[model samples]
Target chain A: MKSDFYEFFCPVKVISGRQALSNLPHEMDQLNVKRALVVTDKGVAGAGLIRYVEDAFQGSACSIGHIFDETPPDSSNVVVNQVAELFKQKNCDCFVAVGGGSCIDTAKGANIVVTEQTDDLMKFRGAERLKKAMKPLLVVPTTAGTGSEVTLVAVISNVQAGVKMAFTSDRLYPNVAILDPKMTMTMPPKITAATGMDALTHAVEAYYCLQKNPISDSLAITAIKLAMGNLVKCVENGKDEDARLAMANSSLIAGIAFSNSMVGVVHALAHATGGVCHVPHGVANAILLPFGMENNLAKRAGEIGELAQYLCGREIPGDDRAKAEAAIQAVRDINKKLNQMSGLPNRLRDAGVTEDKLEAIAKVAVNDGALIYNPEEVTYEEALEILRRAF
Target chain B: MSQSSNKNDSRGLDSGGLAAAGASAASIYPKAKEPLGMNRLFSLSYPVKRGIARVALLALGAGFEYLSRHCDKLKEEISGWEEGRIFALSILSQGPSVTMKKENGAIRCVGEDLKNAEIVFYFKNIDSALMLFAGFIGAHTASAQHRTIVHGDIGIAMEALRAMNIVQSYLYPGLVLKKTFKRAPKMSFGEKILKAKLMLVLLPGIAAAARR
Candidate 1:
């Protein structure tokens, strides 16, 4: 057996496999919950996962206080406050967060208010800023992607400032994350494709962050290979359990990598797109991943080529330059396949980005946090040029 | 924070004639068109999953065509984060080498085109461009795994990273090398595995990694 490592950690108790949701009651009992709020989007509720969630807590000591089912795609600050208000009115003790990142993130924010009486998300913006622990939080992912259930970060869009209010706190980590393959098997192709790409982005970013240690490399590398092998298959046929399992595993693995090492330009760019364009986070990441990768080549030649060979599932020998070139080709080919196979967009411009505004984007991109971590040093003009080339 | 924008700053931009550094060319922004850009720098490692480049390129082309002003918004947010209090973090340090910039009255980040915006941009060729793009995207995915094994860790048995480090000795010796890492220390497979394992543990919500 290949030697394996396990440095990554999230406290969430995952009840996976066929009847994972059935374990919800048992898992909550272990956590010792009495009154838990079920947090989810309307769509998820419509899908009837709510009954299963209720059933999970049926025989348990826990009772449902209320289900704040008003979650949206880009959860705004308004959503957090509203949900928190519902939690208050219902007097819920703990939270059972279901749905994608949005619903789960909204639950996280609401828990902060219910536990601490703090609605000022702006005060807790940076990493490690939260002072007190929130009410017990349990996250159940309805989709294979959006590792939000495990991440310490919760992105809340503030409509007034037109900025994404990124709330990062160790306490933000869910007490439990229930990742069940059956839960994600029902995602439509579009959501599956976008979310799967998001997983790919996470693993890739973690492997290469400046803070990356030996530990992150192995997990990131493995996650990348998994995404490469499974994303397409899952997108092609949503019910394919193997593909679904692979994506779920990769998502879990990648979540560990980037949560520690951090991400660069693709995220920085995607964050911006999510704000102005109303594009989903994963979709934005998928669109910009290639452009960001291409820009990092010269500066990161050694890293790029080595990664390519691994992705190609081969042993690369001889000239580093040749190996690097092969890796680049591999990436291009993979992207071509994913794009052709899945209906995910391949360009920001095609997603309704205007040509005249390219210069401004370049200027803004130069300052995105991820850009700093990008292997190459990129300037505003250079960033603009990248956008231009993409256009 | 008061930097002299004089023509002769110590960073070497002032050493040569402005035209030689490609500053005189007509650029989108008059202040930015001709300033010498920074040199491209690389990270330590990456994932080279098949066909990522072509995929990213196609995605980039499509996104650029459709996304428009939202792309501009993305750029602006990055500027806000960068120009305000860019965090210059060191793996060994308690306080980041630099701090995350906050939007403060004292730190004026005017939404204006920069005369000398970047310290780096890699356009050596299209192939290089594609690799960089693919890697950047790939890194995003990898970061999630790294966090799990490192600082962000909350649970799990005997951190996976520690096990990975131990396994490195029993595993295959690395055979790939691009531009020999500039000044990186040679870590044993054990150490690398340990680090990778830890990274995966701490950062579980996100995947992949990238370095400046």
Candidate 2:
């Protein structure tokens, strides 16, 4: 279905291959920068992934000025200011973010602070609020999900305000995103399964969301096919560089798709679940994707049915509703397989969410900005119903 | 390129010489052309639509103030809001705007005062604002179509949206409501009477607000 009006944009140059990291220094030089601040989390540093980034800079004009590895599982405003302060103190010219969504978002938040020369980030929250050009940012994902690499949005929690501050702008898109198989080669089977499902959810939701357009739909379908083909393989064999690279590409492509098209109920619920229960984002998304699809089935059957070929790997023979059901079932089948393979939880309760928290999660989900783009209206009651069913 | 070079060379001339060159150019150059017919029509329509949008926004603000006093559901919806939390709906870039503040456990229309609004829903242009104000689309559809950009806590925005939905149910007829709202509201006999009352007093309220 074509929309009457839509907008799409992606300016991040993607570099994906076996040794994509080796091109980092050259990319920095292209951006006319010499010293780089490497932002990462302790987990990625602990897993010895920083060495690959360090090795990429060796014998090159650009060098690592500092490595701030204190990024928590969730990026916060405090950490963002800390990173900006370090960027200035270390005299870094650009940022190279290595890790998952947290690291990338932290780097983005810091870029806003550094470029805007503001210690208070709360004033810059919301869409297209950053007027100043950001410092050059290069992202390398150590996980195959959270597609923060290509997205123009960053979520940084304000500890004092007790709310997550979302900053969105075209300027927030990184200058380059490097997808090296070696970076994600260390992901465990469970994390790989979870993150792969996260990418799948991104592609699926982007396809049926209200903002879907021809360009985004094409990218979304390709991403879905790549994820469905490579997710299980990557989970089964973490050493398979081909499958790892494919998943990396899948995540990046899905990120671009959702960044332009935006996501819907699945991400809304997933974010709420993650915020309330401390559940891993991928786990919540993996559990709720099918339910979210089912929630939108009545309004988006045609769009959902179109995903059948990409998700199920074959044309489904039925009406749109039946095909949509098959498409959803295919997702469930993948989840079930991942559960058997890596114990990825297939239900919210099993993923550490208690039944009592469903209502609170529903309340938060209704307030999520992503819900605005949902094809079907998701009120508090509808959101609660979806949560109950997923639970 | 030669003309541009000549203009650049003129920059080196004295002020009197420059003024004389400018006068000569003004006399030599053709008068500015009138806008194309279609462009002229569009320019003419802009103010008409902007006027309609402005009147609609004033009525909307007045309606919120009226319903906050009479509508129970609206009252309940807004009761949880913190005191003095200001929100606004406005067209972008120097367009007429309306701000509402939660005060004394009720919503009060604060007119176009946007200085202290904690949350703002900015329609990208007058056309988008006219779409919603003219009842051509609902709030949910407006948001889904990306006709508006919200700047604030999304949770508070959603709360404001719910309240706006309630006010809309009373302001618009049932047929228009059916077309615009995601779920058409069902009003009781007393509520219907309240709606009738609101219809009677709304124009006068808008007039009073406009006068202010």
Candidate 3:
């Protein structure tokens, strides 16, 4: 279904290929920046992905000014302030985020702090609240799932308040996104599978969500086909650079799709599950996607059914409800395959969520901003029911 | 140069003729100095729409106050809000706004003042505001259409939206509710009576707020 009115914008310059990382310095030079701050986690740094980024800048005029590799799994306001201080102390002119969602979000948050010249990030926590243009940010996503590289939103946790602060604006998009297969080659099978499922969920939810439009719908279909074709191959053989690149492209495409169309109940529940039970976001998303689809089956059966061909790699011959159910079953089958191959959890219990936390998770889920774009209205009781079923 | 030819070249190009042409063009395509009929219509409708939105906001605020006292669901929804936390709904760019504050375990309409608001839900224009107020669209639809923006914590905004949904369920008729809500709310018989009572009080409440 098409929306009556919609707005879509993505200005990120994407450089993809085997040697996409080598274009980083030239990309920075195009932005008239000479110094860059590299934001990443210790995990990515330990995985030796930073070496590729360093190699990209070895002989270039643009240089890495500082490397802040202390980004936590959940980037926070304190961490953003710390990164901004480092960027200023080193006289950096740009940011090069080199990990997954957390690193990219940290760089985005830090960009807001540096550009707005504010140590307090809470004041700028909602949509289009930042009045200043952010510093140039170049992203090299080491994990393909989060797609923070192209998204115009960032979530930074406020440690003191124990609340996640979400900042959204067109300015949060990275100036460049480099998709190098070498960057993701080190991901283990389970992480790869989980992240791949996360990308799938993004594509599926974006296709059927309330904000869906023609452009996003096209991008979402492409993303779903790419993910369905390449995710398992990359998981089974981590060295398949072709499959890895395809999955990377899938994630990036899905990111663009969902960024415009927005996500729905799956992301709301996944965010809640991750916040309350400390579940990994990709795992939470993977576990909750089918249930979320089932929940929306009443309102969005035709749209969901349209996705059956892309998800199952074959046309499903049935009514909308039957095809929608088949599409959902395809998701469960993929989860089962991934679980057998890489032990990616397909149930909430296996993803470290206890039954006792379902109520708390539901409470948080109903308050998530993503719920506004959901096809079906998810009440507190409905959210609890979904959580209970997923568990 | 021939004086007669120069005079011919200048024909119909004198200052008076130029001014007449400009006026003719302005009548067809109005410039900054001349307001078009469409612009005049919009300008006239702007204040009327704003007035309607103002009253609707006041009525909504009043509904929140009333429902918080009587509606169990609304009371439960607002129980988690911090004391004195203020939120507002306004049209962008110097438009009329209504601020509501959480106090004494209930919501209070603080009139059109936006000061001390911890969060604000801004309609991008008066038309969007009127659409929502007139039950032509729901909050989620307006949000999904990007016709609205929030300036504070999104979580708190979502909570406020839930409360607003409850108020709208009572304020709007079942037919409008069915069209606007993602899923039309199912109200019990007592709740239907409460909705009727709310409708009875809403007019007087709007009149009272208009005086303020």
Candidate 4:
């Protein structure tokens, strides 16, 4: 299953298990960092999860220079600028991102600003365009979704311009990704369910996208299997350390897979929804995964059929097309189960996406860069249809 | 959420908004001194950007020439192809075009004349072309993204795509080939020797071409 020609790169050092957070100071010391700026939201700090990270730094050569716990749920250019200022003011030489995607991306954006000595990040937007390596960054993701830790791209909203500028580069990969069960054990079941589904969408899209290759496909399959086996258990009992660790590993694996291969219309549509209506990214992705899978079924039935067995835990009896439909149905069943367990909304309407905004979301989705990797050509009207169906 | 009427926002600059800024980037030489039609600012410094594109395109052309001469895959792909078959790879609405034509079963660069080109792959923007040359994105993915347009026979375009893929297999490292190609070839001992020979000659030839 080797592709004719393909390249795979993941330079991020990963450490996962109990008390993985304790290695953060040692990892930072290896990177020769002296002072670190910790980026997280008020919620993570309020939940006392940041205490573990703070405790990890005690007696280590690497010290916390500042704790900027003001990141909003949605990362913005303003937050990035503020974080950069804090880094400079505190004379921090490294970043410790200790929350979900927003905090991680905010640190990434600020890293670009400080290292590149530019106030504006938009100049570095797009793929592999940066010239200088970002300052050392280590991510400890509190949520088991978004995979922002290992991903090479960061999305920061520019509310003034009404656009979310995406910055991508090989240099953006965090120097280390530390996954600790204690960090995610405190997440509400709803957030847990939504983020786990986000990981699933990333895996499914990586397998079916145009950039699919053997290596990425292998990682994606493993991620899907892990998610299928552990996401529900983690949701049902958040304290189950094994389930939490598996889900964490699944999110990281899926992150690496999709970051290399890229995601498709599901991300495009979900990103647009997050932009227009302020829906949570994972929630939007969770609602739209089945609809997006159905849209791609025609061009990618063989891959979808294979996915059916991974998801449903049994061989489906049918042709490729029939099995693809069965895979889509398995996703729908999973969504319902998540809803029953954690009250995760299964439809756009339930997620608070107004009908009037579907057209706007469709318009933005068609222009998303993710559309380039989609198996099928998606038009604005067709995107609208998917939205309506998901609604 | 009030919209600002000012010409620029805090997100640095969008290519489309540059008309008001008085810094328009024109293509390299042999074309009009007008701004890039697609309006993307070249991210690299101008001298470095132009030099990189020139050398990369020259290497690509020389690689094709070498493949045409020594590679069996190339021969099989273009076997029975009529003479005077020309293909141009160009960024749409700009310069830096490279056209190659089949002459006596070998490929040679024909400069930037579209009239002789039966097939042309046009990048929608300068950014897209630069990204492709930088190996940041694959050709097939670029096409799917509407970043490219093919002008000519659909059948020939498909053939050209296959041929380009073959040349790429010989030119790029196995790792890059694995990333870019749908299926990377398993090279034989002779094929590996041929690729080594091609690289030895192609690198200097591209350097010479770029100097000119």
Chain A: TM-score in each candidate? Answer: 0.91, 0.99, 0.99, 0.98
Cα deviation of B65, candidate 4, in Å: 32
lDDT of 4 by residue, A87-119 (tens): 999999999999999999999999988988888
Interface RMSD of each: 16.3, 10.7, 8.3, 15.5
Per-residue lDDT over B35-139 for candidate 4, one digit per residue giving the tens place of the 0 to 100 score: 343234365665565566666678888888778888988988787568989997876575477788999988877666777686777776667777667665567
Query: In model 2, which regions exceed 4 Å deviation?
Result: B1-44
lDDT of 3 by residue, A5-99 (tens): 68899999999999999999999999999999999999999999888889999889999999999999999999999999999999999999999
- Sorted by lDDT (best first), the order is 3, 2, 4, 1
Q: Each model's RMSD to truth, in Å?
A: 20.7, 10.9, 9.7, 19.1
TM per candidate, chain B: 0.21, 0.78, 0.77, 0.75
Q: Scored by Cα lDDT, where does model 2 land?
A: 0.89
lDDT of 1 at A156: 76
Candidates in order have lDDT scores of: 0.58, 0.89, 0.91, 0.83
**Residues A235-332, model 2: lDDT tens digits:** 99999999999999999999999998889999999999999999999999999999999999988898999999888999999999999999999999
Q: Which model scores highest in DockQ?
A: 3
DockQ of each: 0.02, 0.19, 0.31, 0.04
Q: Which scores higher on TM-score, 2 or 3?
A: 3
Candidate 4 chain B weakest lDDT stretch, 10 residues: B25-34
Looking at model 4 chain A, which ten-residue stretch has the lowest summed lDDT?
A1-10
